[model samples]
Target: MGFGAILDININHISTRLAYWLARNFDEKFDKLNVGKHQIKITSDTVYEVFGIPKGPKKVEIIADKRKVKKQEKI
Candidate 1:
C-alpha cells in the first residue's frame, strides 16, 4: 500500500459518556486528554481521522457572506 498514512478507528456508535469524560480531562494548554492512567493526543488530524468529513451541503455562515461589502484599500 503506497498510502502515506492509515487510520484505524473502531467506533461503532456514538458515546456521550466518553465524550464528557474526555472533555473533562482535556488539557487546553497541551491539547491532550489525561485518561486517568495516561494521556491521549487529540490533534486536528486525529479528530478528522475518527469522525471523517461531513456528508451534506456546505454550511456557509452568515458572517461568511461572499458580498464585497468593504472595498480594499490600495497599499
Candidate 2:
C-alpha cells in the first residue's frame, strides 16, 4: 500500500477503537496498562452502559500504536 493508504488505515483503526471504547466505558481519555516503549492506554471506568456492564472490578485496556509506518519504495 501507499504511504497515504497506511496512514489512513492507522487513523481509521484508532478512531474506530477509540469511539467504541468511549461509548462502552463513558471515558473520554484512556489510561496506560502495560510495559512497553509504545504508550498504549485505555479506559479506567468499569461501568459501561452500552456494553451492559453494571459494575466491573477491572476496566478494559486496548493497546494501540500511532507511529507512522514507513512505506517501501519500489526498486
- Which number leads on lDDT? 1
After superposing candidate 2 on the true structure, give the runs of residues whose Cα lies further than 4 Å from its correct spot: 1-50, 67-75
Candidate 2, residues 3-39: lDDT per residue as tens digits?
3333334343334555455465533455553334454
Structural similarity to truth (TM-score) of each candidate: 0.43, 0.19
For each candidate, the alpha-carbon lDDT, in order, equals 0.61, 0.42
List the pairs of residues colliding in candidate 1.
none
Error of 1 at 40 (Å): 0.8
- How much does candidate 1 score in TM-score? 0.43
lDDT of 1: 0.61
